[model samples]
Target: MSDDATPDATSERAAALGLTSPAAEEGAAGPVRFAVVGSGWRAEFFLRMAVLMPERFAVVGVVSRTAERGAEVTARWGTPTFRTVGELLAATDPELVVVSVPWDVTPVVTRELVEAGTPVLAETPPAPDAAGLRTLWEQVGASGLVQVAEHSPVMPAHAARHRLLQDGAIGQVTSVQISSTHMYHAVAVIRRLLGAGFEPVRITAQRFAAPLMNPRTRAGWTGDRDPVEASTILALLDLGEGRSAVYDFTDNQWHNPLRADRLLVRGSHGELLDDRVTRWLDGETTIDSPLVRSQSGIGQDLDGYDLQHLSFEGQVVYRNPFVGARLSDDDIAVATLLDRTGAWVRGQGEPPYPLAEGSQDHLISLAVEEAAGTGQPITTEREAWAG
Candidate 1:
């Protein structure tokens, strides 16, 4: 902790580390008490968020299947570890549990936690396939406690666009062209941007190939692999009412620096292409402004590089809640999910990303992949969880 730490930071750091502080109890008032199942790379995101935003989150325990891995996580993160979900639940009373395992394993752990009456913040692609999704829904769809942590829509840049669309800054949204992320992740962003509910839609998609250099991952990039031809998947989502979305993504687009991100939100009266917004203020007037971002701790600011917020036209649309945490936009989004999940569990807010929304996103995503592979326009159908 720094000498100039905020009161919340001081108390939270003390409580999270089990220091002899007034707030270090099991039912502490400050941080959202939670635990995680799995200790893989994605699981580390949850741990890092808790560590960075101690006031907003607290990790009670991590359930690892193996003793060696559990010991490794314990030694590294100083978080208690249990061998089984049963043991973890018995030992620590977390208000929520985050399922950060592989797709196949996600439903099982989520089911266990939901059956035990604990709120769960599940990872993306809630299940492996549509059948898995239906089966999982059959088990826990009505529980009203599972919220998937799909961070793209809530990511700072994307969230700013969402806010702008919701305010009708560009008039009625007509279409969105997204070239960031892939598959289900891209679908989540498109759905949110288009304001499309769980409505049935048709998808026409195809895959193309191109050569590109692959560099970097969450771990590191040593330029170890040779440059190779990568495939690009293009999908057209025919959202009803003439509203539509174009999904264009290349393999490793998430980390590839060569492919610049492109976002074009076309509305009836205006359009937003990336940071620039072109909209009509009146019949004879058109205005343009850039989505400005405020960052702290870059030059004169000693706090360190942290995303402050995003604003358009002097109106603050997205404000980073975890300031001075040195987190990226995506990290902030995940932290928001955890914090909101906590609030929902405590009856302070609505469910963040309900299971139905995630299922629908994946539902369309699976259709896109199928359409791309089969050269056909596939239509979506209402699932059991859809409203």
Candidate 2:
């Protein structure tokens, strides 16, 4: 929720969305200084954001396991790289350290950082499996120095839908159907839209295989013309009190051109299908409103090609904070996580996403995999972090 308007303008927009206006921006502060602990693909996202907005974030250093990898990162990003966390920390004291390593190594690095009294922004899952998650929580859950970089809830479209739900535009949200992402990512979106906390859930799932043509991926086009077998997992997560979520995902769905993302949020008064909201305003009147996006660089518009804002029924619900950065929607979400993490570390805002929340999301996701493999219904048990 970034705005370049005056206080009056911001207040009007907030009133339109039925929300109270927030306080004005605080006094100017220096850029957030941080470091990275890995040099993989995910590590580059942080470096890229810093490159795009140098005044907002600063990359103090990066840690790579091998000297060759460190040299490559230094050459590309022009940021100094070290061989270990110890060397990076010894050289520069970063306010926060981002752990973007593999799943198995994330917990170890996070623990090391926590023990050193350094705040951490860990990548997704936080651990590899259930045992690792429980152990990680038992070790660092009480430290209050860890936050997970989960970005689904802050994505533009999802953010607008969340505002609509919170404003009671569709009454109380009862269930959500997510076919956009898989496993933990999907679960995170479901839980956020449902306003669900750390409660027990009953999960049932199954996997199916079918022949589909995936001509594109994150790398680019595959150039192959043949169809290959891919797996699709469907699960029903029963979060008691009549609340539930339907999780549907196909293999490589995130990058496959053959599959389109879909979402549905049902409430007592009406339902939201993707960007459209259909609800009854009165006993005899029902209306449909579509979430419209204002993108620049279209036709004669000269603000460059970027997303400016998202509005429904003439009211702005979501605004792009990094408008001039020209970032994709996914990148925007990740950048939001980075910005919020910086604010949290400086005591300027609340924690963005904590380790307890990330652990629960992965806990249910692992259950989805197990239920599909064993053809049985799995019920989650209370964990130490639930307290």
What local distance difference test score does each model get? 0.85, 0.87
Q: How far is candidate 2 from the true structure (C-alpha RMSD, Å)?
A: 8.5
Model 1 lDDT per residue over 1-387, tens place: 001111244345445554322222222467898999989988988887766656577788888878888777766566788888898888889999999999999999999999999999999989999999999999999899899999889899998889998999899999999998987889999999888997789999999997778787556685756778999999899989999999999987887777888999999889999999999998789999899999987778886677988999899998987775677788888888988899899888899999999999999999999999999999998778975
Regions of model 1 farther than 4 Å from truth: 1-28, 224-226
Model 1 scores worst on lDDT over the 10 consecutive residues at 1-10
Which candidate has the highest lDDT of all? 2
Model 2 weakest lDDT span, ten residues long: 1-10
lDDT of 2: 0.87
Residue-level lDDT tens digits of model 2 in 109-214: 9999999999999999899999999999999999999999888889999999999999888898999999999888999999999998889999999999999998
> Which pairs clash (backbone N, Cα, C closer than 3 Å) in model 2?
none
Q: Whose TM-score is greatest here?
A: 2
